[model samples]
Target: MQQRKQQLLRRHRQRKRVALLLGLPLLFSSALWFWWLPLPLLLAAWVLHEAYFADHLFYAPGDDYDYRFAGAGVSVSITADGRLGLAQLEGIAEADTLLLEVTIKADWRGCWVDPRVLIDVAQPHDQQTFERGCAGRRVVNLSGLGPALAAGQVRLRGRYCRLAGQATLHVLRNPDYACQRMLILAPHADDAELAAFAQYQRGAEVTIATLTVGELEAEPYQQLGLSAIEAARLKARLRSWDSRHAASWGGVPAERCFQLGYFCMQLPAMRAEPLLGHPSKVAQTGDIRPLRKGNALPLPGDVDGQPSWFNLLGDLRGLIEHYQPQVIVTPHPQLDPHADHQATTAALYEALAVSHHQPQTLLYYANHLHDNDRWPMGEQGEGVALPPALEPLTVAGVWSPSLSGAAQIDKSMALGLMHDLQTPLPGKKKLRRVLQHYLAGRRWPRWGVDEFYRKAIRRHELFFVQPWPIKDQAQRPE
Candidate 1:
């Protein structure tokens, strides 16, 4: 019995020895595999999530987001929800670039996340670079980044566990005013006025295009202010009017006649055909497509199938691309004028939202006179004399012609004629006449013109500029 007990003990010892020798490696391998599962799976999951929710996952620091092109700098901030929060850009390259380093850490195993560098320029051109690193040390050669500079701004975004973040850097270049060009978008067919203005300023070369949409041939003239008898008479006189004024004036030819009514009698005339006769060249003339309402020009599409609102953005983009103008001028949003005018201005604002290459300046034009009650008759039987003029009349509100020179006024009026082309109502005629009178007061005080009208409403235009390179919030000036 003792011998049997010894044998059993030896067997037990042998089994224990075997377990001690092999158990550690097995446990170690299993543990290693278990820990590793999360790395690959988590990476895959993260990638997939990012594919769909990258914008949502990345959070911007403040309301302002910034970028740079050449020497110019811009600041723009987007919300976590991807809405544009704050934007300030300048055409001059006066700021520096920002460099950001991203690091990751966990236990002994060290790894470096790719660092993305963004730089905003004064012009549309910008640059970016990406590098991989961890802690304060670099690991990989990051050589594949390819020629660092690009034609547009850089967009950087990423997420990491509970610590994901992103920032933009701006690179400034020297200012080059000679490179500037201006683009004027008008709804009417009077390109001559704008062209003359452009020539007078020695500004960039200008191109004019016309668009014609619907017609008002069947519509009565009285609907446009003529009495029923007047409408009939006007209709009878339509043939003569067409032969006399319907002919094209600007370099661009006139569009087809959709309808022949008084409403269609405005400048550039509302025709069913493309007024410029060159639909293809509309963009070259700096005239965006899908013309807004009230103008003689109509955008391409069926009103029922393709609404003006829907196609406005695309048209604006096309215009920007075609003209490549440094500055864009359109009507103001506040005028609360005609439906088509309002709609066009609204669309222009919307287009500015997505435009990366912002225009340098935006000018707003006042609407024509509407009611005598709103604009009572003054001395001279016209609205108050615009600034730069000595007469006081009543038709529309007074405008300070002093701020804008006669040159500017002439250009503005010319552009207005090009855009409207319609005969001014009594109120509009009175206002125009007043404006004309002011033209005689060539040496008006600058302050007088400057003090014309308080921008009753905020006039906002959107454009992309170089991002300012500001590191610390405290260092930024108000």
Candidate 2:
């Protein structure tokens, strides 16, 4: 009787253990399924928003494309003999025929196919041609030919307005890319290379200029949540790392990298002149130099017997004048979410406004896509589009150009060299939280952040060009 009772008790305990094991899995699985439910809902919302509301920001079927272009203007050069600036027009003139054609480029607005070029063949010798609808062509016809424009010792003079808007962004119509010189501006170190890797492949003489020491992001307090000394050291290390990486990645000598030494995160509020005859949180000029690793000593308006060359605007203009780049690439001035990025754009624009040099194209790229905690968007490869509010100033639709497979790989490698989470900092936290920022959902703990950044690697890149006659001060400041 005792043995039979014991057997019964043992069997009952076994049954209870089996039940508990089965019940735990059901509870765990239910919790996981509940967490995944909202993720799909969020994705659906994003898709709906993009298709219905976002796609039509700048373009619709019947918006009357009148704002497509601006700044149709001309530049004139005259020569003696059967010679004109353009090869086609040079042959147009007979040995005794004086020939001059106006060369004009479509500005930030779309190109004017053939505006009008009026050649003043009127002089001591009134031999010339009166031409209309000729501003857009490199080789222009000498219409209504006369002696001064037609014959001996003709003095030709031309006046042209430098157009502001005419070049519009086109999905199909790519601008004559800048081959000789390219100037890329970044608010911080890693920004330029990420956006402009494709630009480098075009074989342009690329110059990347970074705006600050990049210390703010490594801040001992909020940025990386580091101590001051550690933050400064990290900033210096990052600057050095970026410079080295850019040189190697672009296949250019390292010296081409320019790091303008300014305090990070202060640009948007920075001023050239201090208030009330006092320097109030004034930026240290440091002789208007680039990326000095440490705090700059207080500097006077003038340095070491040199005239006051101590202004942000002046420094940027100096770079512009020096490079005379055919293309000036920077962040979207008004559209960018980051204050430093906006400030960088404004500074570049101000410098361009003052400098005599002109670039054929002013292109803008974007980042700061989501709140720091969210990323991947779960989609990519579609070209970048201007936000609807920015459509009027954008003038042309942004283009998404595809990169070669090798180029994409190179971009990935370059970005990888930028920052990492493997190394630990204070509080036993990783020095960089790029993973936490890039990947979406709870899966981040399971997958590495580098993998998400790599997944974001798209074959196509996108950008908006600022059209001249910008809509308002909100779009572009005077």
Task: Give the distance in Å from residue 165's predicted Cα in candidate 1 to where it truly belongs.
Answer: 58
> Model 1 residue 472 lDDT?
34
Residue 450, model 2: lDDT of 46
In terms of lDDT, the best-performing candidate is: 2
lDDT of 2 by residue, 198-238 (tens): 66656558777776655544443326676665666565557
Cα deviation of 69, candidate 2, in Å? 10
lDDT of 1 by residue, 313-351 (tens): 555655555556565545433322333344444555556
Residue 443's lDDT within candidate 1 is: 20
Off by over 4 Å in 2: 1-171, 176-180, 219-227, 244-247, 272-310, 369-376, 379-393, 420-456, 467-474
Q: Give the true-structure RMSD of model 1.
A: 28.5
lDDT of 1 at 370: 20
The TM-score of predicted model 2 comes to 0.51
Clash total of candidate 1: 69
